[model samples]
Target chain A: MVMSWIWTGIVLLSILCAAATGKGGQLSSAAMQGAQAGVTLAVSMAGAICLWSGVGKLMAVCGITGALSRRMRPLLVRLFPSAAADVSLAGDLSANICANLLGLGNAATPMGIRAAKRMVRGDIATDELCRLVVLNTASIQLIPTNVAAVRSAFGCTAPFDILPAVWITSALSAGLGVMAAYLLGKVRRG
Target chain B: MTDYIVPILLFLAAAMALRRKENAYDVMLQGASEGLKLLVSILPALILLLTAVYMLRASGAMELLSQGLRPLFALLGIPPETAMLVLVRPLSGSAALAVGADLMAQYGVDSQVGRTAAVMLGSTETTFYTISVYFGAAGIRKTRYAIPAALFADLVGFCMASLTTRLFFPE
Candidate 1:
């Protein structure tokens, strides 16, 4: 529901801005370019995401994913009680979090999608599913690899010096995001 | 070490499957197929969102909005120059990266604004991108409060990045 509006907002705002700036001629080209980029992105993602999903599946069958999720069970139970009630749903959630923690972003999305798919109980999203999305959005990073790379590329002497700041800010965001989702979700569900 | 993580994980999974006497090849294929199906559900959302994000970027709207929001962002201690990072970080990943990289380029990576931009990128998630992909895959059309809550957290995360950077790297 909100997504529809947000999507509209961006497109409409972009057109309005373009017109106001007299860049109206650029809007069509921009929209088409974006569409083309999305197609390319999806095509590239298909290969990597599927391979990771395959590997992820093998891990699931071998019980490694199950073990990983088991480790995250206590925490997940409190955050996603409804989804946690199911084995595979919790498993995918656990796997997704673990991958994100390691900064294995390519490996995380497939599990995230799998878990999210299972979270669908009806047309509307449940509180637990919303929490899952919230958690992913605020996932704490054990290694800010991409940021470090960018810093080093720019010749920052102590690239990793930002590690401490990253950890604190990410932890704060993740905690606050979870809390916000919980409180807000309760109000809505009630 | 970081580069070897994926291969090592694959090795462990394969080893375990062999020991368990399971057909690893078939299992992998099954997983791949399921994932492929899930991607079908996610691709449309990705395309639409990306289109909007790219359109917004190309039209210079994001920059304009970011510029307009600089004053408000400054009130929260965020550097006025990297105001665009806080604005676009939630909407698009690559765009945020460009903003962060641009900040580092323009103001030396070791500078205050540069450090804050890097930390902000590392700490916060791409909210709209994640929500759309996750919810779209799940076939959940009506995301009641998730967007508001996540965006709120993002706002705080951006402020905290500025705050923590100042606290840790005081001049």
Candidate 2:
């Protein structure tokens, strides 16, 4: 898999660089520290994952997600057609997209995973699933809160002054990403 | 604000489920259990990937690589100043923020480099982190063209962030 190569490549590159730069000690400790931090993150994320998963289930049973699908159906259908054409998948996908749009990242992941699981039929990812991932990867961050906060910390007069730039860049990336995925998917099929 | 939104969302969803009297508690338990299973499946991949990313950061290869790529990035209108941030942004969110803040500090917040750095951080979505987590949980091993396509989008984002900031903010 591609991830396997990337993971090995980074680790090997790190080791070689560490040896050359006399950072061997730091690299070893950093790897362990990174693993520990990973556990911590996963533990915290477990709460979020569980919460969202449960809330998502409840939303489905309550028809909240169904209602959302109705509102966003036209857009989602246009985005993802027959490849992942299932009624329930639409509900999951809508929840994921809406959460990403609102910048509710914590809520988005579980919903995204749920939808992705539904899309998974074989080991290889489908065109529809790839498109979904592309959309999420290029999602428009509505708030840009982290950047704004950093700017404000540095004593910027207007933290959100860069809002227009943020909107333009995010929109461009999302649009281009979807287009790229569509083209690449077709080319591969050919 | 986002903190409040999550609680409110959960409350509204739960409240609606309760109104329907659809064994909401049992439904929640079932869903949570599914999440727990997913956590089990994904924890190892998450740990390994994080370790790799951190090791890469500490080794300083990113600095060397980004520096080497600056001229290439320049062709796409991406400022040389944000080269490191562009490299690190997809690998680790915290590291990217640290880099962005450092850039902003180094070049006054209002400077061209600083605004471009901020926009680059804001516009991008931590591609590697998202892909690993999403596909890892879904148990999809062969990603095919997805990775390249996502990285391409990220490249576009970095370039556009520079162009957009320069146009709107004017240094």
What TM-score does chain A reach in every model? 0.92, 0.90
The 10-residue segment of model 2 chain A with minimum total lDDT is A78-87
After superposing candidate 2, which stretches have Cα over 4 Å from the reference?
A83-85, B1-4, B22-29
Q: What is the C-alpha lDDT of each candidate?
A: 0.85, 0.86
Candidate 1 lDDT by residue in tens digits, A124-186: 988888888888888587888899999999987788899889988888898898899989988
TM-score of each: 0.95, 0.92
State the lDDT at A88 in candidate 1: 86
Score residue B112 of candidate 2 by CA lDDT. Answer: 93
Candidate 1 stretches with Cα past 4 Å from truth are none
Candidate 1 clash pair list: none
- For this target, which candidate reaches the highest lDDT against the unseen true structure? 2
Docking class of 2: medium
Q: Which residue pairs collide in model 2, if any?
A: none
Error of 2 at B151 (Å): 0.6
For each of the candidates, the C-alpha root-mean-square deviation to the true structure, in angstroms, is 1.6, 2.2
Model 2 earns a TM-score of: 0.92
